[model samples]
Target: MSVGTIVAVCVGNGGVPKHPVAEAKVGPDGLEGDRHRYHLHGGRDRALCLLSVDEVRSLEADGVRVAGPGAFGENLLIDGLDFSALRAGDRLLVRADDTPIELELFDVREPCATLRRIDRRFPDLMLGRSGFMARVLGEGTLRAELAIERP
Candidate 1:
């Protein structure tokens, strides 16, 4: 049981610099308050995006300053888990209420053109640190301080 903490819950209408919310409703498609501008960005396989705080720290160590929670277009900011240990198709269960919200980890998210706003080399610099895309398997309320596990 690789348990991690939800550092933040973020949402965006269409782009980067997503705003962090105290809590949000997770649905089969994605988080209730979120939406994507591009079609390729959203769907069952890529319903939500996740970012590892460890990765953010790595970037910060390299002098990269993340604007905030949604700067990377991630819906969730997680901490205390080795992202490399998780593989595609792996399921993440977030503890909440009576049931755990399930999320299917997809492949690493491809750095998009929007990231250029941060730095031209951001795409390349964040190669392995960009984090993974995910599909919601079980819907539930998401908020900070929640426990998420790779089970």
Candidate 2:
């Protein structure tokens, strides 16, 4: 019953405020053009960040104004997956265009001050809803509307 699809792909050259992109190259380091301000943000174990559309919607319903996908610095926005149910050691297989990419969840992404700066209540509102940090298991190009497999 592994079923999910990528709804958006986002990347930023430096830090927070990542914007949606049509596609991106994912490597062992991370999204090709993306950069991290602190060492905590990027590395083999935290190469990519993922967030669920349902989580964002839930936040919005709670009166938190989310600017939309990428606002939380997520590299991939997926739909139909219960992000909360996923834990460390879980793996995700993505079929991006003709390329296949694999990622393993390492830990939950903690909300940062930057996220709180975006909205005063963001920190508390996004406490456990931030998303997950993952390491790249395979390199490939990722794009929106791609299918995602969880096993």
Which structure among the candidates has the greatest lDDT?
1
lDDT per residue for candidate 2 within 1-151, as digits (tens), equals 4778999889886566788988888888989888888889889999999999988888888877778778888899999887877999999889776777889999999888778767788677888788899999888998998988886
RMSD to the true structure for each prediction, in A, is: 0.9, 1.2
Q: Write the per-residue lDDT of candidate 1 for residues 112-150, one digit (tens) a residue.
A: 888878877778888889989999988789999999999
Using TM-score as the measure, which candidate wins? 1
Q: Number of clashing pairs, model 2?
A: 0
Residue 52, candidate 2: Cα error in Å is: 0.2
What value does the lDDT take at residue 3 in candidate 1?
92
Tell me the TM-score of each prediction against the true structure. Answer: 0.96, 0.94
Q: What overall lDDT, based on C-alpha atoms, would model 1 receive against the true structure?
A: 0.89
Q: Report lDDT (Cα) of residue 46, candidate 1.
A: 92
